[model samples]
Target chain A: MRFQLALAACLLTGAAHAATDIDLFFPVSVQGKLANEMARLVEVFNKDHPDIHVTPVYSGSYDDTNLKTHAAIQAGKPPAVVIMSANFVREYVISDEIVQLDPLIEKDGMTEAAFMDQFWPALRLNATEDGHAYGVPFHNSTPLLYYSVDAFKDAGLDPDHAPVTWQEWIDAATKLTKHEGSTTTRWGLMMPGTYDYCGWITSGLAMSNGGEFYNTGYGGEVYYTQPSTIGAVRFLDNMVHKAKAMPEGVTDTNAVTTAFFQGRAGMMILSTGSLSFVRDNMKTPYRTAFLPRSLVNAAPIGGASLILPKGNSPERQAAAWVLIKWLTSPEIAGGWSRFTGYFAPRIAAYDLPEMKTFITAHPDAKVALDQLVYARGWFSTYNVVGVRKALEDGVQAVLSGRATPEAAMAKAQQEADALMRPYVEQTALKVPE
Target chain B: MVALTGTTERPVIRTRVRGRVRPWLTAYALLLPSALFLFGFTYWPVVQVIRCSLTVRGFRGAAHWGLQNYARLFNDRHFATAVVNNLIYAAGTIIPSLVLALLFAVALKETTRLTSVLRTLVALPMLIPLVAAASLFAFIFLPNAGLLDHYLAKIGIAETNWLGDPSLALGSIIAITVWKNCGYYMLFFLAGLAGIPQDLLDAAKIDGAGPVQRFFRITLPLLGPTLAFVLVIATLNALTQVDHIIVLTQGGPSDATAMILFYIYQQAHQNFDVGMASAATVVSVGFLFALSIVSLRSLERGIHYET
Candidate 1:
């Protein structure tokens, strides 16, 4: 009788503390250690919220995470939450595969605008659609021009003043380039020419050249063939073919980082997310600056955002919301920002004592944050990956000396239009005749 | 007496017929599990993919049954480039690797201690996973600071972009594939060489045939069956193994190394165009099926086997 009573008590306590189990799908776009950090964060959340159990899944790169999330939804096992690329949130919203966060926020007795005001304004554009919130800005980044101070000094260029315009940028690169016989010992400039990175940097250049790159309000159009965009492409073409300051053909993120670290690349344009990695690995002194401008100082935002995928139970979603809130809270957000090189999306994160101290120490990170004044939304569309690849292909062609900038941009524009034709027909072109 | 005999014979014949039917039923019952598995896992998915290829999705309106996906494939320059690239990749990887394997098998057939150590050294690359090998090679192929360029520079050679250059990218990948697979194929060739009767070689030696002559006259002909099997396997691998591509190039420097499977993957996963992906899948599988059938048939007829 005593044994049975003890068993009943144990069962009662177990039933009382039953937790809602949910999975958080995250992608490791930077170093692999970030995945471990993510798991540790989830562990802390689970400890604090005894009623929720969050399992962190290390999904692959941004593209792979998108694919996995879609596959899971189709397979009837959608993850409760996902940290997706900021640009891809638009596609998910269009396909109705993600839950809008407005209702969830309103349930907490707050207006959507008040809640969204917590994040940077530039991030707000990508996180919401048609006046409804779909994603919560977790971490955000803008492109920064990273240059080796040692190389600058070696080239006899002023290390105190980085290039502020495209012409100066080219001149600095040409001066920084080193040659031994027929071989180039050090390249002037290098940027990641692989798929997602290529499109992002290309769009940044276009925006800096006074072009919108793509229609911000619509999902079916791009300005690839516009004069501003063509000018951007021509600039990159001249870097490769005319000035011969950059390497010809495609280079991936790893190669670019490797070259930068080894001082084989005097300067490079890379995302701010790589700041921490660079700080840890680069032995030489380096500095960061805003991307060189053609007509305007502009940089495209690139990073991931926290989202709740559709097709989850109410209880699971509630549990996920708790996790997201905990993650985006100022203390945790600031900690994550310091751990990663990404500037925290929440404006309050910067006001924290720890974040302020970190910024004071890492002036390069401050340059990234300062560039936010010129930050713009990433290029998002109905089929973002396909559309982006269309432009990437053209840019790669021009870099490889295969086609002229004009011809490449025209071809890219045609391909992007064809890819978005179905969406165009359903939305913009479906007007009353 | 004759009527009694006929009745007895009729009962025996009936028993015989029943006995035959029972064994046939047992045979089918034994095959049921594997047959079900093949249909469920293999044949069913193929049928579904073919059906999916015929239906258009994510178009201007709701999906409908049509062949528009196939029509789209014809106009896709990327798909065309992938097909041509795959052909070149197959040709580039298979022939050189096969010749190398054959040479290694002949050179190392004696099984001495030195040969054993040499064989292990040759087979070392096969032991590493393709993804890991590709990553290692990525470092080795780095333009200026990489091992290859560093060594080549000492010899007065200029730096070359191994993976970044479109003209050189596919060739570099093929070289890795060849290095990875030569030893694996060599093992099969060794097995085939062992199966060849030593007396035939001894007889050729007594007849004044040189080593090369004996190899051509006896060894090459005898190794035909093994060659055919290995060829089929290499072809399948050429179509299926894309982990290296994913790691190294991702079909770029202008889609220079894009293979059929990678193209299908991009269409399905990246673009979410299921119809286009399914159509590409059907074409690739169909090509594989037809090539296998034709090669196996021709090889079976042309080759001779000793009992």
Candidate 2:
């Protein structure tokens, strides 16, 4: 027992003087290559900062990252930092699991407003909770339309002059679609229908059709069964089940991208985060356009944010702050953007020489950046994934010929309401009569 | 009489103390670390989960304990669908894997040429890590670029979307799982077959019993304990399997393959609803426990070491 006590003291003394160890948990929201790039960036950081040591942990995809972080917290092993989905920050703020960065900014001799102004105005909404900064904007994206030049030529349409409105989009798709005998040889348009991508693209369509996907001001409401959403689903149904211009059922992201590359799909709607991959993999000439709109050229904001979990030692908190600032600095952020094809949320990153050179070299990247002006807040509700899946399931049913758009939307609304009922009862439903 | 009684009592007392110190006390001391481990790792989290299951909260709001989450689960049609999918998956995986493994073991025992090489290759699927296996299957099961499709097309049959179609998605996962584990389970059956005495089999053969009859009357009845053990293990593996589902089906073509654990993951991780997710974990573990106790014990008693 005496020897055990002496050995414990020695170990404690050794642990006390060790370098500050921190973990940066990030996810590859778009592709696997970005995860490797994130690790490389951390390797550079650890080399530069001798006083601090950081481990770049690949925490699966965005959804998996959130789960790992929560389970770790519950199990009393919280990570120092996490690159959470931008929309999820709102829920974290509500849960009080995330620390407010306002005080930290003030300690650094900067006002909260001035610090928030460093990012694009659209990004601030998701990063701030009730006018206080909570998350640092990281990699960001918006939906973009990608069209194949070969398919356009085959259809006798100009690739450079991409469609800008709903009417033109439908017309171009009709023309681009080709039928050989009874089977369609080429699809006119394709988009991903997996859970995360499905909800994201659908929200983009809803926003462009002049409908608010959810009340950006609140976290408990969505207009799933509204005219705007019905119209969007109906349009997709018409394109696929009715016109046979698009594949029925769910087309995954890889499938859509593959079809586009193979000239089997004339056009596709996918994340701007995929810009780098598309540019690299695509052999033929291609062009990108803003998502076609009925009332407005709107796309939902997509990306992740760097946030500190609430429970951390003071030394670790300081270390995490240092890591976050260094990671989001103009040099690192711009480099990451060039690597991943996601636009750096930091506005000043574009002014840097490397970003400028990279943009000049890749014109498709410029189109992605230019479309940021029309980007809106992504759908974030009290029960975000559940609410999103409610609508996503409905839309999938419509594609599969299992349910009508009207019936699907109605079911979606009811399911979303039920998922949100706990929150609703606690707040909105607790009205003083 | 008194001197004889005293001598006998002295020996009995010494033996009792030795037994107490050697087996009983040492067994408890050895079990201490494991008990503490369970207390910290398993039982505590299970308690936390049970507590959280009875609570209601929004993403960032205060939680109040109630029966809301379970009630919500009951009313959720998706949850019902997930439960049904899990049951079907368990049924699909257990029966085929056990039967195939038994068949492989018997065939391997009878074969004479390159038996060691065959045995080595049979367990190859078990050696590959699950992620690699899943990724390989994902590519192999793809509609166009997949090996399965390529072979089918070559054979003049239309390609099947193994992981894409809702009806076929669960079946595809079960097939992958069986392929991955059947060979591993074959090892257990092979060991069991090796343990059976040749004298018993010779006697049965001498009585004019054919291969099938000898297997039923002599081999199967004697292999009861091994069958029970394999059945329990296979059922547990099938019940808890989620990795392949994550990589391949992702609970879709409309929740056709959403296992209970996968649904819990969606709730906790994707939705960030910890309370609901915790509740789900409790339910899944409870279901697994109930299944283990009832089926496993019954099979062991009714089938194994039969008179």
Give the clash count for each candidate: 0, 2
lDDT by residue (A151-208, candidate 2, tens digit) is 9998999888999998899889989998765445578998888888888998888888
* Fraction of native contacts under 8 Å reproduced by each candidate: 0.61, 0.28
Indicate the docking level reached by candidate 2. acceptable
Off by over 4 Å in 2: A1-21, A43-53, A72-78, A106-110, A178-185, A313-319, B1-27, B38-69, B114-116, B155-160, B197-208, B271-287, B296-307
Looking at candidate 1, what is the lDDT of residue A412?
91
User: Best TM-score goes to which candidate?
Assistant: 1
lDDT of each: 0.92, 0.84
Per-model TM-score versus the true fold: 0.96, 0.88
lDDT of 2 at A34: 80
The true-versus-predicted C-alpha distance at residue B274 of model 2, in Å, is: 5.2
CA lDDT for candidate 1: 0.92
Off by over 4 Å in 1: A1-17, B1-17
RMSD of 2: 5.1
